[model samples]
Target: MSEFQKVVLSREITGVPVAQDFAIEAMARPEIAEGELLVKNAFLSLDPYIGSRLKGRHMSGPAPKIGELIPGLAVGEVLESRAAGFAPGDHVVGESGWRTHCVMDAAAAQKVDAAIQPLSLHLGVCGMPGLTAWASAHHLAKVREGDRVLVSSATGPVGGTVGQLARIKGATKVVGLAGSDTKCRTVEREYGFDLCINYKDADWTDQLAAALPDGITVYHDNVGGDVLDAALANLADYGRVILCGLISQYNLPEGERPAGPNPGVYILKRAQLSGLVVYDYMAEQADYAARAFEWIESGDLRYVEDRAEGLAATPELFAKLMHGDNVGKTVVALGNG
Candidate 1:
């Protein structure tokens, strides 16, 4: 293995990412030292957080530096190992960025049981998206049986899992807000959301209120701006709001946010608003995965992936995800011509 392909960010992105923002080229796969393994990337994540990287800001986590390979989380298989405790043909997941080949320390990744499920599941249901949902539902939101829960970006990876997990956790009604009518229908019919509203409709907020007669007790916020405003008004007393991602605000030009919403709502309703950084809860990742694995094994949880076929598609898929073009997790697959 001399070299393989990688997608490198060429410039800071201003708007919807164009092809010129990324360039894919071959580079030598560096030799692994002791305690390291060379992996062939399998699935590259295209998440909303990547949008923040393009703007040179750090909203929740570390910012990506310019001229670096755009950072990402992915799953891959070890092709060669010079490290202890790893061998050729072992699958692992980590922050390997967007690349066809990677050399990482063994401690940075945990071996994946490929036989238990499709390896791609490590990038979706059993991975960050799933854990994000679990943390929002159980830890941040404290959802309870008979609680009315609402989620925005409902067709995307985080929102999709949030709605389903709410149902499993015994929420009486799970209302979802999605970009399109098709996504709304999928949320209702496929993900078991009691009501799914299309954000494209001007009357979406009115529709959401009508559907949630009991008032929303837990809101998993993925989209911000007007949607967040509406959810705020509909929350019941003692409501819990879990701030996940603000996809709508991620790509806005500087100084674009208008002052809106009073902070007094939290005091008025005695609501608890929480902001979460998933990495802070890493200690519980294994426990979260164990529970999610049980749900997956018993067919109680469902997942979807929007897969792009090659390393060349990473940047394109990243833009697509920011534009809400993908349902569930967006991934770029590498390997096997």
Candidate 2:
């Protein structure tokens, strides 16, 4: 009870993360201040965003210092609370980082229903990823009936949710572009995407053209660089593009970044481009979670997750993710809660 463990950055990540870049250490359990809650994390979400955060390439905030805890989203139970509107034993989701225990500001947390089976879902479909999909659906894109929607990185939690929601909204076709063949199959069979293309294939763009003969009406882009460029080339007359994440070059240091997709393509396609910053929609999270919860319960919306055990497993899990090898949302079980 007197000590806890944390995964820290052992060295600066110059490119994609590797297992050696992280090290876990034990530290003294600390007291919580007023307006803070002490939490015991049961599951940690290892997302692609963490890869950019580790390299200080993301816009979220300053990066963690060397030997500091790496950034992560966690679902856990409250061990003690000094904040209003919260009590001990309540389940909460927050930026608890990669740790067995943490004392975080109450304002950073969203209380989740304990009845929701598998607390890890709070970190995946029902948590930030779900909220991202909802916000993009309601505030950004207009998913018209019979429209063709193409989603990049489609097998992951956010992409799968986005594509499925588009499907529910009456989009005639929901296509996905993933890194591997197995992922493509999973998206088509499990997530209900109309078609899933493995972009790793040399003729993938040709396949996308053949699959959607009319061109894509909406492009929900996650990976950038060439993927964005290619998607733009096949865009319909008036496509709406959502720029979510640019994981393609997220790891590159400042000067090494590419020039990115062409502006002419957007102009030629009359593409309506809107960038998605999830924090902008934070105030409406509860309401959206309620709706997403229902869709999940009713089987209208679906998700997949890949889980690993223990905090020590995070580095390896995350490394695999950055290498584009993991299927679905990747989570690490702490086995503490």
Candidate 3:
């Protein structure tokens, strides 16, 4: 009870990470200082950005050194607090890292609604991923009535939310491209996308072309490789592209990364490309969550999660995510202790 377990980056990683890339080690529980709270992390948010951060490419913050706890978002209960307005049992979400316990400054701890049925949601559909989807769709992409939308990684927390919200926003057609047929089904049946194309199929490009007879008006891109190229080729005039996540190249070294997608089409189509970094809209999280709550309750928005239990499972689950095997949000439950 006086110690904590954490997953630390154990070795330098150049490609997709494996369980061996991380080591679970125990450390003495430190006392909280003023304006700090000792949190018992209930869940760990596994993201591709964590991998990007270790390599010093992620823009959210600097890269963590080897042997340091992997820096990422988490939500947990405050077991002890030295800060005002936070007490034991209150729920909070922040960059708590991959640990069973973490000492966080109160200013860094954004308390969340303790009333949410599963607090883990604050790390998923109702959390950062949700905000990322909403902000880009509404503010950056300007998705509106009569627009045709296409989303890649369609079953993920970000992509799934984007497609559904585009539908709710009066988009004329909302199509998604997922890696597998199973994921494609989840995109359409669960997330309610108009059509979900399996990009792995031999004739997927033709399928995508058939699905978007009028071309895409808003393309919410997550995987930025051939997917982006295909979407670009099928873009309508004045098409908007939201660069929410470029997971396809996350594993490659800078020099080994692929070349740019077709640029000629951008000029010909008058394409609008914008990168959507979620941190820029942290100030508006509460507003997005409020609307998300209504949409969830009204059955207008939907999401799924691929979760594992305990700190030991975090690394493997993340590896699965990098392999494109996860259907939705990737999370690891560490317990209330």
Best by lDDT: 3
lDDT of 2 at 138: 55
Clashing pairs in 3: none
List model 2 lDDT by residue over 71-170, tens digit each: 8888899999999998999989888889888887899898988777678878887788878887666568878798899999999998999999898888
TM-scores for every candidate against the unseen true structure: 0.92, 0.96, 0.95
User: After superposition, which runs of candidate 3 have C-alpha atoms over 4 Å from their true positions?
Assistant: 1-3
C-alpha local distance difference test of each model: 0.80, 0.86, 0.87
- Measured by TM-score, how close is model 2 to the native structure? 0.96
Tell me which of candidates 1 and 3 scores higher on lDDT: 3
The window of 10 residues in a row where model 3 has the poorest summed lDDT is 253-262
lDDT of candidate model 3 versus the reference:
0.87
The 10 consecutive residues of candidate 1 with the worst lDDT sum are 56-65
Question: Worst ten-residue run, lDDT, model 2?
Answer: 253-262
Instruction: Judging by lDDT, tell me the better candidate of 1 and 2.
Output: 2
What does candidate 3's lDDT look like per residue over 1-337, in tens digits? 3358888889887677788888889878868999999998888899878767777787878776779888988899999999999999898998788888889989978888866657778888889999999887888987889999999988989999998888888899999999998999999899988899999999999999999999899999988888899999999999999988878878778556677776888899999999888889988887787788788989899889898988888888988887788899999988662
- Deviation of model 3 at 90, angstroms: 2.0
- lDDT at residue 191 of model 3 (Cα atoms): 93
